[model samples]
Target: MASFKEEVYEHISAVYQTAADEIKNGLSLIKEVWPLIFLLFLALAVLIWFAKPAPPDKVLMATGTGGSYKVLGEKYKAYFEKRGIDLKLVETHGSKENLQHLIDRKDPIQAAFVQGGMIAVDNLSGVQSLGSVDYEPVWIFYRKNTFNEGIHVSDRDIAKLRINIGPIGSGTHAQAVSILKQNHLTPTAPNLLSMNNADAVNAIEQGEIDAVFLVDGYESPNVQRLIKNPNIRLVTFSRADAYTRLLPYFEELGVPMGGFDLGKNIPDHPIQLISTTTNLLIDDRLHPAIQVLFLEAAKEINGAKSYFSKAGEFPVYMNTEAPLSNEAKFFYEKGTPTLMKYLPFWLAEFLERMFFLLLPFAAFAYPIIKSIPSYRTNLAKKQINSIYKDLDKFEQNTIQTFDPNRRGEYIEVLNDMERRVLASKAAKLATADCYSLRNNIEFIRNALEKQVIYKGR
Candidate 1:
């Protein structure tokens, strides 16, 4: 049987062998999974490389009830189709129904022009604003005789008159009711005429109704022509300030005389109007591509100079149930693609997709790639430290006793440490350290072989 010291040495050697084998086995397993791991890495690369889907060949949109939404929807549909996107127009029952349809996940409605206040917080759930297209001022076209009462009409007179409220679920209906309710008029049981703005106007012209209410931007040519009628007059809310105070989202706007046409002098006097915003409501989970498409379209549609809104005011993001997605928020804050600004529409959209794909990788590649070298260096450093402790123990034993039998055993340990340290090849330590230790091992070997007792050997 081997001596005690030899037994210890053999045990240490066995431990070293087992550890080395385990390391090799671990490395082998790592190599096996490396392909799948690389695939995972490459998947992220692919996402960053081609993340954006191609813009749809056809775009879908919604218009308010009556002619405005239909006319505008048709016009935009043609515009987008000219740019290679076929714009599909879906008629909705005006702003409230349009917003409800947008919130319904089952509905394929990607975008809709909704009267802003038509959507309450509960109704706005799961919907985001792409921006508003135009302001729809609450226009009260009452007969000149009914226009008496100086902007503050009494509830009794309003109740007695035949009021043409808009269609059920239309924003116009909601606005008319809200305005009427504020003045203590009860239309719930009153004889109500359910019709769109155009029909209401015709009804009034035909003597079927006494008054009609419409809420739309002043830029509407139809509205321009209606106001020009000598028989019908635009009702100015003398107390517009009070209505604005009652409705936080309402803005008191003025339709200046000759504002529509300076040469024509359309309005003889400035018409005071109170209006609510309109929104391009979309689903919360709407695809980023679709969201971008709507926003970009909105930028073109709503940014025009209108009587009620200036450029960049319609797509307001606040107070929506479906908050704007991060990508949409980013684009809104930073503005749309430069190509969308300068290039033709089709080319700009394609480049925008490519840019979305490449940007993340362009942002994150360097740091992750550089970590491999750093990890290997740390592993080597730990291995070097482990070997150094065993070397120090052997060195202390050598100083305590110089017995011949123990000297050879200690030399073997020194040799073992030296070989293991070289195997580790820890990059943190200088190469000079390994060579110097080798020289010490050589001196120990020489002294053990010759049985020479040099001082401090």
Candidate 2:
């Protein structure tokens, strides 16, 4: 005999009550899964803690001073500075010294400019080449008297050759020996001079030296003297192509007629010469970020046309003594990292390394990451269903225990279970479940009242 308004209110109250209990049950299940969440969070923290150290903030390089290596190294330093890195450039005796520094792993040097042909591919182990940056032409200037005055020294008269190749422990010196060796000179080739470009030029000008071998480009200041002085003649290789074939690092290139001066028409025609490229060498352990920067700098500085190469001809993809590093290969294949194109260098580098870490985590933890909701729902449902089963067994006990004393104990136990079910509602429970647990509580109360009325007497 309830009014329509009262009935509607009662229905709404029941619905809200059911929803509250279902949610509380769900929360109890979630509480059971707390241990899983705690462990997962701990693992994530460890991963972040042990992430690879930030890309090196700086690096040291070995290069030749007062030459293209020094000049180009300066340009590279500038480029690195813009990207928040510092380059420590150390000047050394040319390619040969550079190679020694790289081989000595204990040294702090990370990179250097080494001329090709100085070291054989077999000898290179822990280092790698980015690529040849530019062609290092072999400029041989000799006294005109050797050939013009009929004073040419025969093959065996190398003792009378009186040549200055370059100083010992230098790229030009190595190239000089290589060239002489190809001509069948022994390791201790006689009359081999050890002098730098300046002294070599002075000696040639004074007729103190018969010939001078310079491994550099037309940009060399000494080469200018050879070009301008009519008393000196460039020694052209008659079998340049054959030399190139014998030496993997050698290339048969020509110094174009009038290349130095169109007015004087220096060579009068193309003169054949054997040359090697100046390759940038890197330690195998150098940071990959720095490697990419070196390549980018080389492309910018050596990609232009020079006396020996056309525009975009340098930073050659050709192989060198040391195998190319993986970073160099990647740059050659993919140009630049996709992230680097948009983000700042520091940010991009950090994110790139992080992505590598996250990639593995995402792959290996796919199941772990996915089981969150599954475990949550399972725990929630388990809690909800467990309470219902306990109630069922208690209800059966009440039906079976008909003795007054036993029924009184059953009622007490039933009351205690209802109190526990209501207490569980204090926890954070799943909201979707709409079981208030009130009906079950009411059933227990009614059963207890029946026991008192039917059996208490």
Candidate 3:
């Protein structure tokens, strides 16, 4: 019986041998498939390089100094914060300044709430729209006692009075200038004062300015305060249809009687207002994922039913001041991406990028992976063939020189070659070739023995 220690050593030796064999096979396989491995890595590197970068953790958006735009910006900021993103809001005069910020590449503002009709669409190039978010009506409020009672007010009449057409570089100012020009009135007239929404509201409330032209939503504090004040009256643009025709970007909005306050019958009459949409514009170079996030935020914040908008009616492709972004177009066509519905924002984005990267990589790597076994097999055959060539050379030398004096040395060389063949890793893969080599060695050894015996005789 084998001793216990000897048996234990034998077991350890067998385990070690198995592990070494596995390592050798792994290395051999890697060597044979090295080119395929290199190609796969190269393909992966190219895909990663071309892939869209991850959505930025911090972004800057331009809102208005005050009014609904600033309010909307706060809502969007809260939405972004929930997704682990920082949305910094920069307050400007209004849409005109916001559009300028978006167009200037050096400006840190990546997105803004731009009012339609503020500028010509042809002049905007570096900005794209995530679509219009809400209605910003051209609210014309005047002191009830300023104009003659029960008389219709004309654009020319308003231009001659002390009127606040909003600050320079504001959407209200742009619209006011356009309206005044259409009426053949001078917008540069001294009576067309430039004041911001709050100051203009205050000036009109104090009966200092005869009237104020504001472009804002009904929810704006300035518009609301003026609406509640019995002293100020909201203008009903009787020529609203003509204005829409003259200003192609303008839309006509109707407010029924008591639209402002049904309890108090605030307006006391149905009103026709000329309005424009608030477009969510972004830098054309903004990341696609971030654009998608903005669109989603628009849906959540602006899609709700409001005084002027029906539920899910906004965030639509209406009154687009600039071309719709690719992401926004996709969103309108298909809603939010499926991944974003269930997963966290960052994780969903990561998986989406990886999916796109791996899709092409898998197509490239499949054939190479499938051929690895064949490549490794071919390598094994080549190694066995090399040993066969050495055997053939030895046989030729033996037959030509007839080295009877060094017969022992020739036999020793044959034994060494056989030993090497049996020990070779390649021999395991080409078992048939290894067996054939052993048979050839035996036949050569027998011939050497016979020749030596015959020479001695």
Candidate 4:
């Protein structure tokens, strides 16, 4: 007769074999759900790719001119350099040249400081304006006699005088040419000279030039000097209403005399001036992150309290050459960008990009995550049900196999199987199952002992 230990070892081996078979069967069933598994992996990959690191290297900025933009650009370049961004400063004639550079494929300029009234999108293509930075008032500084005297000249009289409108490629030149023509002055008859704003101002001071037109910011040093000058006078646009009505590109502004200095009492009365705003232009294809960064920079740079402007008066988006970019539009309507203002620039850019990429997966992923626990529970129940099948088979066979010699071996094997299954401790099985299994094992053990003693008798 076999020992109890030897018998129990065989039964325990069989139970483990059965458990392996059930595990294989479960895997086969799950194989049918390959499509869902594949989708889960795909979603994971997309999340990783979208949220993956953004460019950590360098950012590019475009700067133009010898004026305020150049000054502001220099400051930003220095600031960003310390933060590790590589700044690219480009020199152009003025705002008009800057806009053309952005639109031109040959030029790689990403952004520009574009003066107002210089762009006609009807002619140019593939460029957009972020928003206006500040105003460039059209300064019509003239010789002493031109405005002080009646200077009544018909279209015929305008043809007789000498005028230095602006440099050929400048934004001032574009608007000056239009206004002069509207007033019935021909370009050739006035002996129009193409001179820069500084040179024109100098000539007006010396009486070398009859009239000079400047379309530049009020904070410009040349403008300040002209404002304080008693000999030279700014040409007052008495027909401010007519100018605004006819020139849709222009807005009427008042240069309060002595506005520069209330103590000095410069101009006793206000001087009517024609003004237009300078816009921050970008290529239509420029990255959205760049657009957001620039708007953030402009908010701080343009709106500061200065000699010419009231606080919060600049960086306006209402009138622009091109429509505001989506990022810029969001900023204007909403109070402030939580992510951009609070987070690092590259980090904010990453979050913005990730939002767009993850939108499709959210609906599917949320439900899967919620149902995970129930799926795991079903798996546990299935494993316990497999153990129950083996238990039922052993119960049916125990009664039929009733030989005296083999009885001890059979009882020992059944006892071992019961011990293993009970040790598995499946939560799905009731507490009563432990009592029933223990009783059945004891009954088999007692019966086998009784048969052995009967055979000996």
Q: TM-score order of candidates, best first? A: 3, 2, 4, 1
Tell me, by TM-score, which candidate is best. Answer: 3
lDDT (Cα, tens digit) per residue for candidate 1, span 1-457? 8999999999999999999999997785455345444755896777956575676676567785445676667766765766677778887778777776777778877777777567664655677766555666888776666665355342234455687878877787888888878887765746677787777887777677887778776655556656766566666677888988897657788878777558777555677788876666666665665566666766677666555677766555633534566767777788875776788777877777777665676465555555545555555566765766666676566666667667657677777877787775463344555566667667766766775644554
What local distance difference test score does each model get? 0.68, 0.76, 0.86, 0.68
Worst 10 residues of 2 by lDDT: 150-159
Identify the superior model by TM-score, candidate 2 or candidate 4. 2
Query: Between prediction 2 and prediction 3, which has the larger lDDT?
Result: 3
TM-score of 3: 0.88
Query: In lDDT terms, which candidate is top?
Result: 3
Error of 2 at 243 (Å): 1.0
Residue pairs with backbone overlap in model 3: none
Error in Å for residue 178 of model 3: 0.6
Model 2 TM-score, 2 decimals: 0.76
Report the C-alpha displacement of residue 429, candidate 1, in angstroms: 30
Candidate 4 displacement at residue 378 in angstroms: 11
lDDT of 3 at 292: 90
Off by over 4 Å in 1: 1-52, 121-123, 145-159, 189-191, 257-266, 310-322, 342-457
Flag the better candidate by TM-score, 1 or 2: 2
Q: Which scores greater on TM-score, model 3 or model 4?
A: 3
